[model samples]
Every structure is written in structure tokens, then in C-alpha cells.
Target chain A: MAKRPLILVTNDDGITAPGIRTLISIMNTIGDVVVVAPDSPQSAMGHAITINAILHVEKVTIDDGPQTEYSCSGTPADCVKLGVREILDRKPDLCVSGINHGSNSSVNVIYSGTMSAALEAGIESIPAIGFSLLDYNWNANFEHCKSFVKTIAENVIKNGLPKDVVLNVNIPNITKNEIKGIKVCRQARANWEEKFDKRTNPMGRDYFWLTGEFVNMDKGEDTDEYALANHYISVVPVQFDLTAHHAIQQLNTWEFNS
Target chain B: MAKRPLILVTNDDGITAPGIRTLISIMNTIGDVVVVAPDSPQSAMGHAITINAILHVEKVTIDDGPQTEYSCSGTPADCVKLGVREILDRKPDLCVSGINHGSNSSVNVIYSGTMSAALEAGIESIPAIGFSLLDYNWNANFEHCKSFVKTIAENVIKNGLPKDVVLNVNIPNITKNEIKGIKVCRQARANWEEKFDKRTNPMGRDYFWLTGEFVNMDKGEDTDEYALANHYISVVPVQFDLTAHHAIQQLNTWEFNS
Candidate 1:
């Protein structure tokens, strides 16, 4: 019999969130699951690590399950670091972050705590994936995506991910019957048009709320945006190497004095 | 005469940090400068944006300088967003973040608040650069790298950056005379081998301080790590698109049931 993969589970949503709770249950059926997640919510914390502060991690049982769980006071990336370095006795076969309550598609991946966790694991050479649903509600229905999630995880365990690569899987906010199928795609070229809502405090101090409209500028039909809009689960292979390799030759032509 | 460029200056370090203050003074020499930076240090903050909290921004006079400055209670990325959407009357000719207190070379870029600000600007189609010194001290010497900083910023302003690209510049901690020239390079494959310093609190609670030894895995002479080690200022063209386009074909072969 093949050994069950050692699966490390985590999420940007706090350890108690329904999104992670559903992820935990789904992961347990496939592997020797171990969860090391943030004690509180840490959305939009892209690739952040706890460098200036101390981290506190404690074992906690959220529900009846065979999986071992520990809650940590840190960002999602910090959780993965702690999970790999401090908690896990051995390197896991895979790391899966989030059944994120919101989409981490396109430019959102730059600001996503969920995807950052997966990227962090990828840096450590762990086959990893960050799963998100298009729904952003706290009580988002995750039942419809359970089988899909299980199947994806099984496939990743069966076939390891490429070097320096991790998966960003975003499911549409639709029922299982309505979901067309999974599609591998590139991230769309998109950005948030920020609108800061300004208000004056009781003390006559002014503050602003950060709000934005997501604008997809890419006309490519092969993008994650196109896949999700067509009711398909979009899986973008994400890499952490930020280098614009194609521009290197052009940059080298520039003259710089010593 | 060519119109003076409008340069937006920011950093992961607080408004009062020596690094940013140095950056502001340098940008003043090339253009009409406006400083919008975090109120407190936000190192390793990545691309975090304030969505759950209201942001407070106030105009302030940090030092005797020609540049106008504003301090915000947010991450470096937020400063760039606010500088673009609300503060600047016109899109700046360029955005320069940092003269950061430490190196943002190799995998450090993944966790860099300094680089994230530059990336945020790049996303808005603004030419941006993030500069860092090899020294991590708050009071690190900046005089040695001033010419290199000025040259790079001038070059970026003169030759606009490529589409969807920014620059990650790291200077060696050497004297001006000892410095080699600047080198356009790729980000080195490196990672921090985290060593969490576990300690017990007075209340009998356990905690950890995150620390690490940087391990450079890539031996490429054309990498940012090699340039910095050779006392050359390293400039790696960076991008915000996280897609691993090379891996898409392989991922497409995976089986996922609808």
C-alpha cells in the first residue's frame, strides 16, 4: 500500500474560520494532516513574515478529527515557516493553504496572504497549492467544492509540482453541477482602482477607508479571469521569482559610471 | 531645458528613518519630490494593504528639505496607492522606494515592503525602483552609495522602465572608492534557513523570535547576489506578474474531475 502523504494545511483566515475548517476536513481524508494556521485573520498580507516581533504557537483541537492542529500568532507566511522549521518533525510531502473566502485571482495574488503561504512552501521545495473560492462571504458555502478539492490534492500527491512553482486554484462561486471543469491558466493583467473614502473623526482628525474596483484589462481568453468567468476552476501556476528575465538584455545595454 | 521630473519617494522604513530621509534628499536633486511613507517601520511587510482598518494620513515636515512629505498609518504599498490615488495631483514621472536599510536581494524580495511599494507603482504603469544597502543597521552609511543611487534613478527617469517591470537595486556596504560599477542582473535563488529563537515568557508562555541565515543556492555570476558580493550595485528588473507561464503546459495535464 502506498503511504499517505504528509499534508500541511494552513489558511489566511483564522484557524476557526469555516473556510479553513472545510479545508481541514477535506485534507484529512487524503493524508496524515497537520495544520499550523494563524490564530487570527491575516488577509491581504502578501508574503509577510514576523521579523520585528515574536511568534506564539499553541496546540489546539478545533473539532473531532485525526489531524493535529496548532494555532500561531503570525501572518500566513510565518505560519508556513513555523510549520516547516519549528513544528513538523519531518518535511511534509505537500502544503496546501486556504480554502480562502475570497478570490486570489490575477493581481489579487500580489496582495494575497493565502497564495503567499503556498509560495513560501514552494520556496522550501514543497509541492503546494492555495485554494480560493470566488465567494467572499464569511458563511460561504464550501460543500460544493469539497470533492474537487480532494481530487486536486490527490493529483498533486500523485504528481509533484514543478520546481519553484506552486498552484493558485480559484473556484467560481457556483454549485458543483454548475462548475464546468478545471482549467490551467495564466494570471490576468488586472489592477485595483483605489477609492479612498475620507471621513473626519470625532476628534477632528481625518481618516480614509481603502476600497477599490477590480479592473481586468487583459483581453486574453487564456487568463484565469476568463476561466473563472466561464464557470471553470482556474489554476494558475504561480512562481516567486520576481525577475523580469526578458528585460535583462535591454537593461544590460544601459551605461552606468563607476 | 528638459522639465524636471516629478518623483514620488517612499520606503518600508518610517518617514523619519535615515534611509528614507536620504532618499528624499537625493530625489530632490533630480525632480520635484513628494514623500509619502509609513509612519512606522514596515520591513518584511510584503504587499500588505489596509482593508480591515481605516488609514490615517497627515502632512508633516520631517526635516529641512525642498520635498513635501506625508506620513501614513499603513504599509509601504498603501503609501504608493495613496500617493497615486489621492495625494499626487498628477502621475509622477517616477516612484523610488527605499535606500532600504538592508538587502532585498534574491528571495528577500518576496518578503520586502520596500520592493512591494515599487511593485505597486509598477502595477499602475509608473516607473519605479527599490534601492537597498547590504547593511541592516538603521544608521548605515549612505554617502558611499549616493552617486550610484542618483545614477540609477536618473537612468530610470531617462529611459523609462519596460512594461510591467520595476527595478530591485542592492548596493554593497563598501566605501565609494571601493565600489565597483552597477550591474543589471537576475535575482539569485536564495532562501533564509529560519532559526526561531524559542524563549519562555515570565507568564510561562512560550514564544519565538524569527531569525535566519541567508543561504544563496544559485552560483550564477549574472545574479544579484554575485554582483553585490563583488562590490557592484545590483539592479534586477522585477515584475508583479506571479504566473509561472513555463509550468502551465505541465499543469494542464493534471486530471481533475468536474
Candidate 2:
């Protein structure tokens, strides 16, 4: 019999979240699963690593399955680091992150712990994917996202991703039937209109809770936002080489005598 | 007279790093400078924020400069967020980060706290730039970096970067004379060949210090890595939009139902 593909699983929503539970079930059917994810939630932790603090890892059994699990006290990226280096016997055939609680669409990819895990894996030359849903709840309808996740994982197993690139797959918050097929798109030109909620602390010191309005300025129909709005799963093949090559020539025109 | 540009300054090498100090010095020449950077080094912190902690900003004075500085307990992204919504009086004319201790060239852009701080400003509709010196030390050469920083800041003040796009400026680790003119280049296709240095703690626990060899696979002459290699200041106009637009059609072809 052919060797089962070794799959490394992770998520930003923590090891206990239903999202990872569902994600694990799908991977069970695909390959030998090994999960190394954060012990608690690491939402919005964009590419953060635990350098300042001491890291702790515990052998965990979140569920009784064929897969082995280890809970890590670190960011999503840290989980991947542990999964690849310490836990797994070999480099994983694929590293999958999320079924994230919310969208990692457009500009969110930069601030997303979910996608960052995948990006970190991609940096290791591993074929990685981050799967997020449009929904933002703990008990989200991850059941609907299962089939799509398996399909993408299977496709990756068949045909490899581009070098130094990873798939950022975001599924709309809808039933599988209502969901339009996946659409590969570019990062949308969008931003968060800042609105900080300020309040006085018990000591009368001012503190602000970060909140905002997401404003999409890009009118281009060929964007992740556009694809998600049309009920399509957005698969942006994100590259780690963030060089804007097109702008290089324009920048060369500037004369810097100093 | 046109109001002194409200310049928000930040860095990944901590608020006390010579890089941010040099940045603040240059900003004082052009605008009403407000510094809100991490209190400690946050290198390789990408776009991480302080959602879990109640972020605090304290007034700090390190040098005799026109700029008002505030040290923050947050990442580079948090500094930008706190700068606009928590500290600064108004939206900045230009937000500049670093004179970073090390290079944020090539694929390092994706994993850069310096660029993320700038990207945060750009997300807030402010013109932003992230500057870095190829030297990585507590006392990297900032003397030669001054004029180039001033010139770039001046040009940014004169002609704004494209909407939603910020500039990532990387200077070679060389003297002013050895430095070639600045070249606007795309992010190079390159990555760090990561080697985690594992060590046993005093408590007999194992820990790893993330270290790496930067391997530039991109041979493009117009790449940021190439520009920096040739002793040229590399400036890549970076965008916050993380979408991969071209892949939508290709993803749509996949049969998720299958």
C-alpha cells in the first residue's frame, strides 16, 4: 500500500475550538494527522512568535482519534515550528491552518494568525493552506466548510502549490449548496477606518479598545472581497516575496543625491 | 504656512533602538513628530497587535529633539494603531518606521514589523514608509543613513506614495560613499534558510533561538535583495492589499464537489 500523506494541522482558534475539531476529522480521511496548535485562542496575532516568553508544550488528547495532538503555548506560527521540528518525525507533506472563526480576506491576511501560520509553513518550503470562514463565532457552521477543505487538500496532494507561495482559502458563511465554487483572486484594496473606543480605567487612566470599520476602496471585481460577496470560496495564492516589482522602475526615477 | 506635517514615527527594533532615534531625528526636520513604538525589540513581529493585553502608552524622552515620544507596550502594528487612534492629534502627513537594525529585504518584507507599522499607517489612509539599514546591531551605522532618510521623507512629503501603498526603504550596510543611489524595486523572491539553535535551559528545559541564513533565490536585477546586494538603497512600494487576484479563475476551475 502507498504511504499515507503526513499532514500537519493547526489553527488560530486554539486546539479546543470546533473549527479544528472539524478540520481534524477531514484530515483523518486524507492522511496521518499530527496536530500542534495553540492551547488557547490566538486570533488576530498576525505572524507573531513567542520570543519574549517561555514556551510550554503538553501532550494532549482533545479527542480519541487516529491522529496525535500536542497543545503548544505559542502563536499559530510557533505551533507550526514545533510541529515541523519537534513533534513530527519528518517534514509534513502539507501544513494546514484554520477554519478560522472569521475572514482572513483582503488586508486581514497581514493581521491574521491563521494565514500567518500557513505563511510561516510556506517559508519552510512546505505546501501550506489557511482555511477561514466568513463567520465569526466559536460554534460556527464549519460542517459546511468541510467538503471544500478536503477538496483543496486533495488537489494540493495531486498538484503542488507554487514555490514559496501558500493558499489562503476563505469560505463564505453559508451552506455548502449556497456556496458558489472557489475563486482565486488578488488581495483587495481595502482598509480599516479606525475607530478607537476610549474609556477611563479604574485608576482614571485612559485606555482604548481597538475597533474599526472595514472600507473597501478597490472597485476591481477581481478581488477576494468581490469573490466572497458573490458566495465564492476565495483562494489567494499568497507569495512570501512581497516585492512590488512593477513599482521598481518608477522608484528608480527618483534622484537621491545623498 | 502649510501646517507642519504630523509625522508618526515607529520601529520594530524597540523605541530605544538607535534606528528609531535616527528616524525621530530626521522627522523633527520635516514635521510635528510623534513617536509611538514598542518599548522592546519586536523584530520579525510582522503585523502583530496587542488584542490580549490592555496596551499602555507612556511619555518618554530619550533625546533633545522637537519630537514628542511615547513608548508603547505593543508591536509595530500596535504602535501605528495607537499612534493614530490613541496618541496622535490627527492623521499623519507621513508615518515612517525604522532605520531598522537589519534588512527587511526580499521575502523578509512579509515578515517585517517595520513594514507592518508602515502598512498600518497606509491602512489608515496615511502616507507611510519603512526604512532599514542592512546592518543588524545595537549600534548599526545611522550617520550615513541620515541624508537618504531626509531625502526620501522630503520626496514623500512632496509626492505622496500611491493610494494604499507605502514605501519599504532598505539601505545597504555600507558607508555613504559606498552606497549607490536608491532604486525602487519589487520584493525579491527569497527567504531565510532558518536554523533553530536549540539549547537546554537552566531548568533542563529545551528552547530554540530562531536564526537563519538569508538565501536570495531571486536573480532579478530589479529585486530589493539585488539592489541591496549591489549597495543600492532598495525601496519597494508596498501595498496592504493581500489578495492574489489572478488566481481566481484558476481556483474556479477546481471541482470542490468532487
Highest lDDT: give the candidate number: 1
RMSD to truth, every model: 1.0, 2.4
lDDT tens digits, residues A118-199, model 1?
A: 9999999999999999999999999998998988888888888889999999999999999998899999999999999999
Model 1: colliding residue pairs: none
Q: In angstroms, give how far residue B181 of model 1 lies from its true place.
A: 0.4
Worst 10 residues of 1 chain B by lDDT: B249-258
Candidate achieving the largest DockQ: 1
Model 1 misplacement above 4 A? none
Identify the runs in model 2 with alpha carbons over 4 angstroms from their true place: A52-54, B202-204
lDDT string for model 1 (B156-255, tens) is 8888889999999999999999887999999999998999999999999999999999999999999999999998899999998889999988887877
Model 2: per-residue Cα lDDT over A129-243, one tens digit each? 9999888888788888888899999988777776667899899998888987877788887877767677889999866677778998888787889989999888888876655
Give me the TM-scores for chain A across all models, comma-separated.
0.98, 0.97
Q: Look at candidate 1 and tell me the lDDT of residue B230.
A: 92
